[model samples]
Target: MCHDWGESGDGAVVVLEGEVGWLSCSLFSHPSVYNYTSALSTGLNLFWYRLPAGHDLEQPIGYSQRLSKERERLWLQPATAEDTGQYICMLSNKSSCTKISMRLEVLARDQVVRGCEPAVAVAPSQVIAPLQEGMTLDCPDLQDVVKMADSSPSVTWYHRCQKFPTWGSDREQRGLSLQIHVMLTTYDGSYYCTVHYQRRGRELQYSRSINVTAVYPSSLPKHPSILQPTQDHIFKVEQGCTQVRLECRGHFPYLAGDWDIWWTVDGKKVEELNNSRFFQNNRQVKYDYGDRTVESVLLIQNLQAKDLNREYNCSVRNQRGFDTHRAHLEQEVPLPSVELGCGLGVTLLLMLVLFVVYHVFWLELLLLYRSWFGTDERHTDDKEFDVYISYARNSEEEQFVLTTLRRVLENELGYSVCIFDRDSLPGGTITDETLTFVARSRRLLVVVSPGYASQGSQALLELKAGIDGMARGGHLRVILVQYRPVRRQGWVRELRRARVALALVRWQGDKSRELTSRFWKRLRVELPVRRVSGVEGGGGGGEEGGSEGEVALRRLHSQNSTSSQTGLITNTVKEPQKVISIAAYL
Candidate 1:
């Protein structure tokens, strides 16, 4: 006799023949139902009955007649040949009703001996083993049972009597092994393997079970971490220093041989306790929380200038990953000295002040020096004419030379002016007259113009005489007055030679009063000091003073009324020509 079980509408059923079995009539409740009275009210009620062979209706049976004293189990006595019939179990509640029936055919003992026995036997084995969390668990091999079958069998795996769905289909027979790839503590239980086979037009099933226990390791280490030098991680070292010390630390779980720590300068690696300029010392520490920390001290000895601005890397590595911290060793910058800065500021200020003064009052300063040291009684007695004027042969230029310049020098400025056309004796040798006048004059004023450059002969004669007088070391000074713009291309050799020796004053038109004042002042500075002679003004004096000279000049001017009136004189020895009247004043 075979027994089977199935679930009905709010209950479960169990059918058996000629054997003892328990029937649970309580309906399975959903986990969400919290009230006990509500669950009990909806539970299944049990009923039992019997059906005679070939009968369609069931005969009601009482629990006291066929059930054991427990009333939850039904017991059938031995010698079941008289009990060949159908047994039915019914279960009902307010929400559902269900029943199950099983037929029993009781044959004689000799007839049961003639039937075939079961061809499959489930193996019995027990396993008590400890597995890690990540390890795999395999079921017992079924190759022997599979070999006995004609074809490959179907296999199902269960954990704790429930279906195991981690592996893709539980029914697998090709390999005859079930695997739990990654085991956990929840997987620690009895695992069942059921094999199904077909033999002689009959289906056969067998089962095997094993127990597993999962165990965890004592400690698991994470990746190492560096935890020292919290603020910016920058190291300052002076150039040419003796040594620099740096510290690096890391934290990790207390697992031996799982972490490595070191240091690197730039990109090259440095080791601990090495025989080099850069070396380190390492130590390991443990905490109560099972964490191991490692620290390394780097010693860079005999630091040089080249070590400045270099990066030092501290790296830690373990099974998980690595970490690096960088520190820079730089030279310290020094502040500037106050004394040096003050000295530089003073020097610049003085230079600027001197430049302004020189730009504003240079002429006044020169005049002051000349007034202090320029006059000498010994040289004043030897000088004759105060100034000699030279110009081109053109009548207009001659008139200007005789009238404008001569009037300013002799009349207004009290200087005796000499010109070749006026001061020289008519019919005299020109070269001799030129040299004589240039020698007698204290200053040779050459009035230069485009017309003057064309009169090569007269300009050269005057320039050469003046240059020779200057070379002779007399009180002869040459001054160039640029009356008009003149090109140097037509300049005579003598004029070119005197260019560097002579001082030039350009004549802007008299429209600007400031310019005219500046012009007169510059020209007067070049002239010699005025000397008073007893013969010229009835004053007898070997030493000249400023007051005496002014009086003598005023008296001499009163005597030369004709020359002062006309500012010119006609050459009396030959054809009439305009000339500067210098002899009357001299």
Candidate 2:
């Protein structure tokens, strides 16, 4: 037989080789070569043949036929030296002939008795595919083993040391190939393919191991969602130097490099805000279920009013899907600084005005205060006399106060007057009489003359009594009548102190009508109004004395008579001589 070979008419070729332990061959028929032939239109009439070493060249040797269903492949069991020969495949038609051939050289039985190493080369040593994709593991070069042995080997596949089932059509182990319709994580592990054959009537087995690593990409359980700050997703902050935080989260199956979380403001990335007042924080949490969560936070510090109503977006993404949430920042209303300043200014101004009024117009203020809050009318009614007269102890000063002021104020002004000298009982203590009269009178009229201060303790006693009475509830008021322009040097310590608070009057004297003078007006203001009775006598005066010398003599007589009538005299005097004498001087 010819060992050299050539390409067939269709440019198809067959290469077959057999070593001491393996046999393999590949026969390829060019479909275009039979395109026009009717007899072999289907190109299905291919056949396999062998010519033994001693057989006739024209005869075909056929025993234990082994060929692929398409007649495109042929294998044989392990062969001895007797089975070494040429193997051929023929494509025939009525008009043409195509032949593919290979020669097998088998070793002696002793050489074939050697141990079976892994004769099959399974590609690849490792198989990796994503889940849900199809994959195929092939035991290549098995045909070479078949060519040496002259028998096709049976291929079986095992997964994780368990024999893989071929019950489902989707899973198959054909010849030296195992096919899986779809890959799954459950199918990940070691896979072994065992090739069982007979060589020289001896059963032999060989196997190739491979690892199938199925990659299962993580998937999102649900869409991403925002997990915090439930209120309308609006955060309220003060205008100045404020901080706000927002969080976005989502759930996904735990898959490395499969999920991403980030924050954005107004469609701008958070990192882009590094130069601005915004900051970012990120976190991820895993759960017991093959699920996990990713959280993204945005922090805004020193927030401004312009930031109000600005939208912030938090986004979470994965292979399954992506989610985004929106939140708005709002500013709270603040009190205006101008209004606060105005309120403080008004309060201070009012306080200053009150202080000025208290210092400058104190007397007037006191009078006004008394009118509103002083003792009622009942207090005034308790006073027995409207005026208490304190005069100098000297006879001339006494005579002037008794004749002029007492006569004018009591008779003309309809006032009840208490004249200490006249009202005091003989042999009574003067101090007791002074205090008693001062207490009973509503107004104390002091005759402030140069001689009054020279009277020693008598003047002191009278002034002290009046001051004491005024101090007790202020029911009694004091009037200082400057009868004669007394010098400041002559002023007693008590009088100087009391003068600031007392009512002072400068007598214009008989030079003008005393009733119409400012002195009388001011004096009457300090004294309460006098009450009138129906039985009161009309104003009276005696007929002018016969002469100045005669009036002087009668005044002495009238003074003696006034002193003799001490206990509450209703009328001054009924005798013409006394009334006429006293009225003449007035």
Candidate 3:
């Protein structure tokens, strides 16, 4: 998300007091070392920092005669205990950054105490040797003695604190390292090494311990296993795919310790094919238990007729075993020519019909996808209402809202819909609570109509609150729903600004009554992508809910038949718009 500090490498540098010690930047130390001045000439910058022990912050290193920083090496002349800490070398350029850290441990000269107890514990070293194999073990930390004495030191090796007999013991003593003819389980023990060197006209002894471990030639199972291509497999190439890859995986174990899996096509190595179309790649996987697996893929680009019959083989091998698998590529059989000729006319007609249906009912298809696949908005936000209807009261728009729009949104689509007349309760101040409802809702649905914003209504106040909530809180979305056509000049400034960015939907009375009609589909598209679920009075979790198409058809029939529905829309005078008492819905 921010700056990547890049890969870091760490080690330790041990030296003695009153001696000149050099710590080469580990960033440039490959097997030996890299030229730092050459890297600087190539457009890279380097910086050095000192991190004292027990301190969280790093202090930048300054060059001086006592602590000279010459290019990539940090030189400490007459080393002191205070100089013991971590040294970091940072290398960076325009594109990337990296650093290397090394612990600098400065030790003081010790008095000659024979057969003394260990005053300091050295960092334990782990060396792994394969069983029954010849290996070498070096005495560690001799470099510290070399640094202190300014001369190469003599080393003595012991196992379990006893002189290691060399004759007939399968072991030999080198200058500062030891060699074993064969490794056994008994060899897996701590070995001690003592460095004897002359420093300042006096002989000093430095002793440290090293641990060795005996490992199996191959961990767990010894035999290699081939994991792909069951006996006599064939791959049928598809019609449109231009490239194909034949992957072969193998498990290998070896004391020789090399992944022996490879791919050969038609008795020739994939690399030896000499054609640009044939290539192979390999991947190796290692486990914590000291075993590994290798996989190879043979890729064929722009396959030709001659490539179909070629045999592909994957082979795996270890010192213990070897296995190979073979397979072939093939082409699918073609359809009969008679059937293709007879089906051409019918296929064209079917495609034309399908295109027409998709063009006309794409909205219905989108609505279905939303209910089935879209996420619920409540999962991401803390809100009380999903839809808040702010329609003018005592008007034809109110009848449309209560009868059709509110019923469809709440009962059919299972949204948390809030209506001013139905949701306002008797415990809070009406003016403040109504605005609170606006604040709590995620979507503010404004019903614009010829009768909207009547002389005594608070429609304009609610509209202003919705706009302010969207601007300040930034989570609320305001949607304008046109109940009937009105002049552009008649709309409030807030509604005019909103219409500039929104596509307004016009109501067409009975024509837009069907839930699948263009008007309702467009409105549903603008609503939030949400999961539809069972709500109160929704006839939920049963046959009625499962068959939404049938339910919408039933409602349509009820509207048409006056015998089944009451004529309240044309006859009843709207109830005196009730003021809130405070709580049922906001």
Candidate 4:
């Protein structure tokens, strides 16, 4: 017996060695409704591949006398313990491609091995959930197997082969499902469940393995909240612009299909308003750590007087609750017309002055504004360091970080920075201390150089810790500083990935040494905003402040003369003539 044809799942099969084991594609399974035979008649092509994939990759299964395909079902005449990894069955054609993978655990009867006899199942044995949260595990696709037997489903759980982890709780059986009060990283491994039943006056078992990944809790599912088109946000519209667009964006975690973001105008949905000009379009983007961003755009074409008075709302909702942000269009205030006397010359001069002010003093103005208005990350969490510098010790990069980057970021900029050599406490394991530092820091500033990775394992450990923390959606964010050009192969895979995904700043010889240079500006933008007790305004104070920031840069510029190639690191990891721009996030 099989499951419904519409159901698509990946399951595990446990078979004893030397026994004739049957493997079926669980992409669409059915006993009599629709099976592989029916799929082939409908012009679908099926291919099988053994998993743990070969050197050539997901290659199709080769011909063998012991293995034969009868009515599109894979038959292992004498299953061996060597064939105990995963297997993928691909159902495809010219237009579409679908694949289902199954773990085949072939038990050897010759040895006293812990084993279970698994029957047919139709669901995937993979589970992913947030760490520290209570999670429940179920034996998916076991319904048919249990129903066929004349007994209740009493499941036994196994972790990492057959060894179970420390439960630290009451081992209460909750039907066929198991529950954990708090998910931990220690439980991050494969788990198998076996359920015994009576069939034909004989005992039988059904087993499956579920690979569990416990990610950081930041990506945990929650009620939808708006990211943009803030509450009662008003967008200014000009008299000549034909249309106005209002966009609302929100981030959701897992099960994005169950959530929605939409627009409503004047207490009615966009479709219910019955206005073609008020139509809306929605899009959902999946991010890493199982987070999704949903955006709803409300386009108002041929804007009219009534449209200005009407209220527009962008609402987002999940199973828990919903969040709505109201938006309104208001007429942009026009500048007062001036007589062609001295007013015109004064206006031009004023505009020039404003441009110079903004172009030259942008960083100062931004820092001042952030100090006053921006939400300080300090209050939100109890992180000790604002920045943690990861670099190769006893090298030019370390000198640059300790003497230049560290000094400026700590002394000039009011930020608590943690550098391993300078700040690490006495006597702690390298892995534990480095990982802890990465966790407690708000940002990791990786000074990438040729010597960093090759110098020792400690540098690589720090780099990996930072990347892992960021990937987990933990408190630490990463910022890559290309101190000097490194050969493509010299870079670690994770570091290369981090460079591609996170913000990257390059040192451009003496040019980037200036505080006013683009390199420092970009690097400063990624750093946590320093809280200023009082505003540092006035021409004198600003100049003094700028000069102070320039002091260490100038000192470093005079000290080290780098004779390295200034080039961009492309996806091919090849050295190119162009420089890589620092992107906060793509």
Candidate 5:
């Protein structure tokens, strides 16, 4: 009845009376990447017991054991016949405990159970197991009798070797057919199916060991191989050409699996087959260097003076690993061969003669607007204008207005006028002298348009500068050409402070009218009467007393005829034309 318990090459086994217990070399303890630990709900509990010598019924003594709850391990000293019958190791957190028991039946060699498959291999089909699901694997046939818990096909699942849970139908419950509702990591390896059945009134048990190698992707490539030199290399042929080859390898579990490889040159991927430069045992870089011949071979061929001292890299890869190697060649080239001649010089001269850009800068070639341009150097006696044209982005439109005004002033009235535009500046510098022009001018004509207002931050900044100039008592003129009529509410609030309003020209309506020309004629008539000059009105080019809002509304009214007017009445309400004026609703 007394028996010894131990581990051997084939796994746990039982020895009957008068039998020599054989231990396989595999059980001697070797390095194993497959080693894992199991967890129980509570501390580990080890139960050791044996039958008395000469009596199968007497309780055996002298069995002592110790277990570590923190380490989850149990150790027994001097295992003997009276020391082992059934040794049960159980883990429990006090709340719950899972138990696994091994029986040691000592007997003669002739009493051995024949044809029991002690070896089993379980391969998981997936990386993660969802709760309440069963995974399938090829079950090893053992002892001509395979029983999951000595019954039909349902076996309770275990973490290490402790029962987790068991449930299944008769059809869905055999061999590897037990299901446990447990959300588990891929590393949760302890699992097995046990067939439980009765035989001859004695309790019989058959269990298959479940070794779950939780399938998951590796954290890193097995072999991180990289090419040394870049594929695109600037090389001096006098030294040597760069020669590159693909070097590939991987590590860990990937070595036990299949993989592929590939390569990229410069920025483009080089297919393995098309290039004659690559030579191998029919193994192209396209195969990912998996084969023996292509694993570490250089793809660049014919290292010559032309390719000398160049850089190139060879890349190798697979599903779980990658590697690269860069190379350099040392073939020297004669520098004396490179030269230039008189024929080439003559061709260059002819091209220079034909191409204008070769002789002139782009600015000198721009369209000349002679009358609308000015110099940074202004004469001390330069006559000041009643208005300064201040525009941010609409240089073209400003130039057109400048041309018209210049003709109106000089040709028609024989007055000297100066205008500044981007084209007017010889070197495109908006210098202090430009600001001086703005300061000297009696009035500033700011052409407001949506496009000009939104050109950039600089355009807005320029508008701000113009406003600052106006605040210093210099006249500020605003010419709001109805450019698509997009309402700018914020700008209107700011413009309310200045004694100025837009010249409202009637848009294309059913009513026939010439509002722009009439406004110009009105401006001509008002110019002599309202001109502000001298110190009290000095630099304040606009008339000292007029409501800007009234002017704006009056201009708006002038554009409409009584017949086409909306059903709204207009009345004149006397109020200060302050910059921040809120007009009365009329």
Candidate 6:
């Protein structure tokens, strides 16, 4: 008979009788209880193959059931944890066959979340470590861990909302334990754990909070600390002498907020101390308030011999913490005076001559230059900019310049472009006007030809102007391109030391894959794209931190070649683009 056996989980089995030719059983998920089969007698050794769901079993060609009197079931030699789910038993005789059902429940331990008890606790109540130094977190013992389903679960550790670089994810056959190590500041925040369950229907989770404290040596003075102009209490009385201001530096581990500063004179708090002011690390006192300042300075004003003997302490107080520092005045040393009519007069004469020459020549020339040309109009517009291409003439390298520009602007990002041409200069010296442009730009992209850096006067001047502009917070974008290789050395140091150059691109031209990958990495740092306004018919632009746009831009730039005019890079490498044509805008 064509038959099979029901799984043993729902209570089904096979029986054997003496002189019987064969007996077979059939089993499967039942529609009703009518399909249930009775338990089997002790005769045939039932070999049950337990498997996970979707387990692949190498099917036997024919069914066979052998009888064993010593053992009730056939011995599955050296059974593994994998052999622990559900199985079917096939029974057979000479003529026909008999079948039985069996179910295997693998006892696998998932995880043990330390319940009720805090996972970790510091002993000294407060834990402190120097900033950037190493620290540790103690984890509790995992002694009661047991096999829950049929396999063991894993223990994962995390800190500061970031995963620790070093971790353990390996599985052990016999035991389970873990030691979590962390470096301070590198790991400063809440910590938790999650277990990857081997069992089909169970989950493991645990969590705990940790407080990290950073300490520094000999922090700024706190409120209540004494402050004075001189370390020792002594000074000479003098007319028009600037007052000595007192200050207190606050303690380290500064809290994150504004703090109040105050001074204590002769055991009494001094109110309206005009010279004292609050600063980040320390309280400051100015001596010359009337000297010239829109805001009150921290310097003390007026000098008196009696004031030197007095004691003054400065202190700063914040809600989270406070600190004070003490100081005493010392003997005042008078400014040394040389023979006024001789040495001082000679110095005065020289300064007068130099000042007159500077005003007559340098100052006048600067004013003339400023009035003639004025500032470039580009700086008047308001846009946070990243780069500006500043390159000299190279008829041979024009193609390279244009290609690089398009790659950086259209294909790569959302930066504004201002291309300067010598032919477009308005009736003035082109060299002066170009220098003005380089100075106004945020970053200068210098397109260097094979001998561009070595080229005559004007090229060096443009490059120098670009360098000077960058010294005032502007960035430098260098694109050195040439058909013939240029050996970079000596005076051409920056160009030689360029992090990302088109020349390097040509070197790895043979390995296009690696070269392209490196080129994109360099572009990401140099040319970051801006958030684009969502179009009425477009799908994106609602994401935070430009992640949506970044992903889109990455997909666009991964093009293999410049083909169609649509200018869209085929991002077959990225996820299939969801081109949603929205009729409505948000």
lDDT of 4 by residue, 258-346 (tens): 88888888889988988888878888755645567877888999999988999788888877788888898999976665555579898
- Superposed Cα RMSD, model 2: 25.7
What would the per-residue lDDT of candidate 5 be over residues 465-547, giving only the tens digit for each residue? 55776566545433343323445553543444442544433222222123234333433332222221221242222223434
Question: What's the TM-score of each model vs. the native?
Answer: 0.35, 0.29, 0.33, 0.33, 0.26, 0.23
Name the regions of candidate 3 deviating beyond 4 angstroms.
Answer: 1-355, 454-457, 530-538, 541-586
Summarize candidate 3's per-residue lDDT along 247-348 as a digit string, tens digits.
887876545455488888888887788988988888876543245667788888998877887878888887788888888887777677788877996899
Runs of candidate 1 with Cα error greater than 4 angstroms are 1-343, 375-381, 393-395, 402-404, 410-414, 420-431, 453-460, 472-475, 511-517, 529-586
Candidate 2: misplaced stretches above 4 Å?
1-379, 531-586
Tell me the tens digit of each residue's lDDT in model 1 across 392-494.
8676777667657865565455566677665555555555667788887778899888777443355557776777788877557889988887788866667
TM-score of 5: 0.26
Instruction: For residue 540, give model 5's deviation from the true position in Å.
Output: 26
Ten contiguous residues with the weakest lDDT in model 3: 577-586
Instruction: Give candidate 5's error at residue 448 in angstroms.
Output: 19
Can you tell me which runs of candidate 4 are displaced by over 4 Å?
1-123, 126-130, 133-181, 185-223, 251-257, 285-293, 334-586
On lDDT, the leading prediction is 3
CA lDDT scores, all candidates in order:
0.59, 0.60, 0.70, 0.68, 0.38, 0.40
Question: What is candidate 1's local distance difference test score?
Answer: 0.59
Which candidate model has the greater lDDT, 5 or 6? 6
TM value for model 6: 0.23
The sequence of per-residue lDDT tens digits that candidate 2 reaches over residues 62-90 is 54533232225454433345556666666
- For model 2, the local distance difference test gives 0.60
Worst 10 residues of 1 by lDDT: 577-586
Per-residue lDDT of 228 in model 3: 83
| lDDT, candidate 6, 347-443, per-residue tens | 9999999888876565344444543555522345443334445444454454444455534453344444444441123344445555666655555
Query: Looking at candidate 1, what is the lDDT of residue 460?
Result: 57
Q: Indicate the residue-level lDDT of 144 in model 2.
A: 56
